[model samples]
Target: MPLDLSRRSLFTGAAGLTVSGLAGAGLAGCSQTAPSGTTDAAFPPGAIDPHLLGPAEGVALLSRNENPYGPSQSALDMIEYAASKGAYYANQEAAVSLMSMIAEKNGVDPEQVVLTTGSGEVLSAIAVLYGPRGPIVAPRLFWDTTALYAANLGMAEIQRVPLTDEMEIDLAAIEAAVTPDTGLVQLCNPNNPTGLVSDPATFQAAVRRMAATTTVLVDEAYIELSDDPEANSCVPLISEGHDVIVTRTFSKIYGMAGIRLGYAIASAETAAAIRPVVMSWSPCTSYAAGIGCYNDDAFIDFSKSKVTEARDMVFATLDTLGLDYLPSQTNFVYFKSGLEANAVQAAMAERLISVRGQYMDYNEWTRVSMGKVEDVERFCRALPELIEA
Candidate 1:
């Protein structure tokens, strides 16, 4: 399909704010108690080579959200076996078996599951399959790389809808942004950076509203770590006959960030459409370690518990510091420290601490991922001073 490159009309409506951060009334504080101490690892600035501070060190506070924990034990075991057999092409049996387990787990058909190097690859696949020169609607304040993929694929018109005053997606604006050229609609749950969820009703309504023409994408990369995993997912919408595709990642919940495994769940037809778009090699055996982790009952339960504990700890710390933060259901807290997020983030780095500086969209809010219990305590103590700095 040829790419479309014309600009669409500027969205000017109550819902078209074109940004994420907004102040609203009566927001209740998190229902958790604060922590103490400085368990957070120091990324002392000027101590380590500046080149070493990659995105990981720059946003160390939100490490957990980015799969800092690495692969689970079972995943490691699988990787060992796969590496031993590295002489061969990826283990097709392992891939099929992994897909089977994923399908069974998600209550979908194996045919409906498509593995990719990472969900990022899946997103790129979506752009290729659907990006034949039309307007694609996405939130204005969204994951930095999402729109880039579409635009790279020759998407001429990129419609960016803003967050509402309450910091949720304005579905009406999304609708208004859609035009005949509209081919895809991508949305994230408990959205990236800001950490707000659209709730079930709003999600269902948005999909229902978009079903007439567009292929709706629900990116649930952080869904597993969220407060209500089941409620915040779009899997139910797929089951209810919407033209929706839901993508989940093992990187976040299974702690296999290094393995780089992610899966997409959708209607069999949609999945079929996406399969051809996926890279030929598919996911490799080394990346299949996450499959082992997903299958480990003990590890899955423990991982979920750890996430919950960290969520409470971070939220409590945010409250004690008197910082305003988006209510996060995911593993990170998106809070504004009444300071330039980058500056405070830099100061934290000087203390050998890493926090995700809100760049691009919500620069005032810094997103800190939930860490070990002790880490949570250290951040609690250091945060007040950093924010005040």
Candidate 2:
């Protein structure tokens, strides 16, 4: 029988489940914390410090490319409501509703959508599924989740094409690198670290050509923060039946990184092939947060404005220091630091600021995500001294 996916059925049935009864009978004994005998010191060196998981007070956190202004009031309210039924396994309904929303938003059928714990899961799934077929082709420097995961697992050979002299994704070179045996090609639009977006027409054409022979995975994790998301996205290509998978995340613009909800859009057949391999599903809170903010335009605009402001400030600082940097479309700014990337990262960490150090062979460049305006201001103030030091 087909599932009842109506909003009323979803919410009402979810609310009727007894959390206390379930928790008391089955979950009360479970613990996520360390066992009683374990201590923090028992962990090996480089284990994640729990204290560093959330925001660290007084620290300017610009390392991870996260939206600093997010989890809007609406998302928070929905999450609170969803938490009431947390003990119930609502994964099926939650996945359907979120997938329906994503499909509607992208102008695709629900069958063409595959939700994951995060976009990373889908990327990894694609890598594992296709890696055994043939080699994966990608730009030398882009968000490398799929290729790196496959290579590290000894599943696929990565064929890297260098970026252009201007440090932009060399679309032409990428197209030239594709062979009939190439199983997948990965593209990160408005790429991470560099924050450069390929020209839409050229990118689309290149993707279409590449898709004729192999599957292409476009990671649009930051596309919502770009100057024009619709124009920049390849979702329409999927609608046109291109063998392309475009993955998006609520973590960036929605400020819901902790929520862990994201998805992939593709041709129905392609989506089906990829879905079964995904290892995790998002929970109720993630579903609620995604439902609440998936179309919250006002909050999106506010987040974009603040990110632009912070990015411009970084550009100004780089200008004053006579440093070259890419004009960013995403929230982060990548700039020539004129120092070893590790040294720059260390100096900034000393000042209670966190920024990324290096990517591939770009050892002298630094990538800084847009934090709160005040924190960015602190980074701007400290940069001059750090460069001189």
Candidate 3:
């Protein structure tokens, strides 16, 4: 259901990019955190896979940053209909339609977009196109999955720059690090592990500066959950004809991790460079569900409200327990565990809670994904016991 241009024209103010929020919510490939409710004996249509853990009750999986509320009713109904019809394979036309809407929202030509299994696949494709003994520049302590992808492909070295003391990405440092031989530069706005963002104007200037020497990858997997996803995004950079690629997912905000769908926006030339290398496909069911959710402002608003409630609960508990934490722009928060993070992790695991640790260089830093308010409360109840021991 591609929205008519007349209807699309209605999106102009705060809701301009809100229509596309359902498109790029994000997912970490493995279920480091299972779907919010781990107890039901019966698996739901898009239930969390048992990839990392067996199903059970009262398990709070705050490690994955997944949407606990799940896909909108409209999306769910579409998914159910697709599955009922046994559309086991993906449809090319469906992908075309989905990308058409995404392109319109980003103000780019449809040819400038490409679909991936998840945003993670787009990262891998970028690495595959430009790695295996190339200079990729990135933050020293940010998201590592893409770095790990390059490493596995034998990327010789990634020139790393440290973030500023205030926890924002050091755009100048990154620009300075770019060399004539640099293949790609990565900027994870509202960075992972730190949950902090850089100034958008400064970010765009850096992208323009670095684009001269190398391809820039702006991973905005968590951008939709930001206070103003539109202003913070890099799609505008793409619209202005920069060699930048912005990848996002439906796993986080849209609650479709199990369905596995995401896409990338780039200049037509950059898209052309990466298109042939990607599968050029998304599951038919995923496309249908995405269409159903694309403009569902009610569900998006409700989900954001839920995240706010849960995030506040987490912040309040962190303060009560005398923990120092970074202010967040997304659904999760990063805090100092004080004790051995692994020990805290194991302790919580025993209590049926899963969290994330082992970020770049901090032993005390822990990343906790926002769950339902009650789930965060359970984690808070378990925190004191976990850290004290």
Candidate 4:
């Protein structure tokens, strides 16, 4: 199917789900404690290379793991409308509405959901709220946010586990690494830079084991983009009364990273503990846009389908090149280039294309986000010359 690039008008009266049934379901169980840190004091300016993407007219922008089709027409219109209200600040009403919607959809209580600007805020919060308590354990090639923030807070204990031969986390090895001082264990499902997913049952079992030792944070930023996303999420662990936090985002599948709307799920008490540490707001427009994005199921299905198609084509290309790659369950592929990462990145840059230089313990790897069909075609064409020369 050809992409629907045109804007779709949103129903003015129904920008989001009706507020009729949502009145008494307010999710204010989170403590109103003022977040402990300020931006200047909490986030050190030069913490880590933020790895910001450089998008241009002709650039493929395969570097950052972001959705290419972007939010649906309905979401865009909703954002604009919400912003035009000229509300000077982020709206808690929108957050309340979002929590209600999420709770109802997932069969969880509204108070258990913590809305943040994006999962990144919750990640940083975990560092402050939990990281200072003990050492952090994580996969070396996974999302680097927690490690970076933990360092920014001047806390030095972090253990990076090496991925297996197949680029998957060995749950047993991770369990073995947890010591008495282990404060938190972080996992990014359908992990970035590799895009491999863990079995939910195995993940829950690992959390059950780890919960006895320390808190667990499951960063599901890409879960909705995974195969059988419902089973890939760890939110259910919260219901089982585990000290597990599942952070999610509308950024990947919903194509709304710019909107800055995401959430974290934990026991209501745990959520209250993490909530006070967050400093950013999930803006009024973001909240409104999130609602619109959530309602636009058509766009979500379409984007997922397109991503699968593009991902398969890239895998086929890598096979033709006889290159080995981590079999992906998400929108990207991590492949062996048989060349130095920096050189390949520089070459791709010259072609007005951007990809990542993901260095793993065993090999030099490159990961490319599945982009639009045309962008992927440009990437496939340019990949050979860059890898060879």
Tell me, by TM-score, which candidate is best.
2
* Top of the candidates by lDDT: 2
What candidate 2 gets wrong by more than 4 Å, as runs, is 1-52
How would you encode candidate 3's per-residue C-alpha lDDT over 1-389 as one tens digit per residue? 23223311211122222322222322353534346655665557777555434224678888888887878898899888877756466555666677788888888877777777777767766765766536778988777676665565465357789888877788888898888888789878778878887778888888988987788899898888888899999889877777788988887788777777778888766766665545335567788888778778788788888888888888888898899998898888989978777777777888888888666567887888887768788998888776666
Provide the clash count, candidate 3. Answer: 3
Which runs of model 4 end up more than 4 angstroms from their true locations?
Answer: 1-54, 360-363
- After superposing candidate 1, which stretches have Cα over 4 Å from the reference? 1-64, 67-70, 280-283
Q: Which digits, one per residue and each the tens of the lDDT, describe model 2 over residues 1-389?
A: 23344533323222222444223222111234544555767666868555545567788989888877878988999999989989975567667877788888889888778776667767777877888899888888887755666676667788888989998999999998899999889889988778999999999999999999899999999999899999999999987878899999888888987777778898877876776666544678888888888889999999999998998999999999999999889988999987999999999999999988777779999999898899999999999998876
Clashing residue pairs, backbone N/CA/C < 3 A, model 4: none
For residue 190, give model 2's deviation from the true position in Å: 1.2
Q: How far is candidate 2 from the true structure (C-alpha RMSD, Å)?
A: 7.9
Global lDDT of each candidate? 0.67, 0.81, 0.75, 0.75
How would you encode candidate 1's per-residue C-alpha lDDT over 108-130 as one tens digit per residue? 77767777766766666676567
**RMSD (Å) per prediction:** 11.5, 7.9, 8.4, 12.0
Evaluated at residue 56, the lDDT of candidate 2 is 70
Model 3 worst lDDT run, 10 consecutive residues: 7-16
Model 1 error, position 25 (Å): 39
